[model samples]
Target: MADALTYGLGPDWEPGEDGLPFRRAARVVVLDDDDRLLLVRGHDAGEVTRSWWFTVGGGLDAGEDVRDGATREVFEETGLVVRPADLVGPVLTRSAVFDFARVTCRQDEEFFLARVPSGHDFSHDGWTDLERDVLDEMRWWDVDELAAAVAEGTVVYPETLPELVRALLDGWDGTTPHLDESSVLGPST
Candidate 1:
């Protein structure tokens, strides 16, 4: 549910697949000093049972730089202020289509990497109404826990997220991966 319309993005919409509104977003894959990754749990607004875990980020504003947008989104969603310079490579680029808040949307997203202190403070003080409706739980997950969750059928975006995290934890290779449509997890059930 990283679509712009689901999180207070501008009204500027680009038509996408089958005339669905399109948006551009900047997402952050946040890792803590302890090597745990921080993610947020989101439930489809129209169907709470349709849930998944994703990184900390959301739609960017028109003309907003990706790194700036990523840091801004982090503060808005987690109450932690991150500087743009602190953000690492927009390590991944992706296109995703899905249903959120009852509307199907297409989004182009750039994912960046961030490292924060363990147990960094998080607050919902800046959430938009739509965000409050969909994003609820936030947690730091270790690789094994994420693997176990996925093994149990928990839905996570970009299906190979665990592997990506594992690789990043081992050390970023400086290559920007393109997670094409094939990587998107599709519409919520």
Candidate 2:
């Protein structure tokens, strides 16, 4: 059999077992008019202490387009409705293999950007039971706060997120760039 892929941090991180499936997922980087980015804090399924902050998103259901999946994910996780055309990316595409809820899978992800009015209400009425169990909190963070969190050992997915947000804040054109692996976090292979 081929070598399994590995992800996450530290010595405890391990490779996936044989025959794990691959999943295609979409993520949204929701920003408010104030330039603060929205994030959700959650633990990996079946684990409590290993929480991390990630953008709003999840695996696409069968037959769903990437943009459609992203829009649906954002609404489900944040209760904010947005048009698929309003989302501004596939800003970054990445692949990683990791375990969530003790199930190992390789995930291909596309990240998109969107904006909403400041102080939009975050409602959990749409969250799945699984999401409710794993998700701990949601917050809007400035770049400085995100940098501080990284410095303080908080794990944030797409590791280059803060820099990306800063670029957007610094007048990035709406074009989406395919992020290099070196620019984000993912399996070495």
Candidate 3:
């Protein structure tokens, strides 16, 4: 069997007192005018067949607010520009614990919704070294494609992402809810 893919801190990284490093992150659920979602493919170092797809996001810098962080992450990961006020969340907060690259962490993430024009450029020019190391490709996926990928055992973060996207496209109520660990998919064990 192939080794499972992992995403988190690397071997040389360390956590705080709890043995799990805590991170505050902001993620953008980017949709095009056609309602297709944009997702990125990633692979752990040296792992080819075990790639996974995830939204555009990352840890918030100290003193940065969530909306600002979301905007920054989107631009950094995809080269798309968006105003903080245009983002439509703290739609969901996801708490997860996992081990990746031999390091374990507890990540608290906030998800925001952003809409962009179709065919917008998703360039890698803005990525940090760590992001460039793990990220492989980016694509736009319609709902059916996303659902098919999930059914085929492709790993996607938040586990509930497809449903969430559908909800948003179907007309989100604009309420922010907390997504507990049970609703999230952590690292494969």
Query: Backbone collision count in every prediction?
Result: 0, 0, 0
- Candidate 2 lDDT, tens digit per residue, 64-96? 899998999899888999889998867778766
lDDT of each: 0.79, 0.74, 0.76
Arranged by lDDT, best first: 1, 3, 2
The TM-scores, one per candidate, come to: 0.88, 0.82, 0.86
Candidates by TM-score, descending order: 1, 3, 2
> Candidate 3 local accuracy as lDDT?
0.76
User: What TM-score should be assigned to candidate 1?
Assistant: 0.88
Measured by TM-score, the strongest candidate is 1
Model 3 scores worst on lDDT over the 10 consecutive residues at 1-10
Q: Considering every candidate listed, which one attains the maximal lDDT?
A: 1
Residue 23, model 3: lDDT of 67
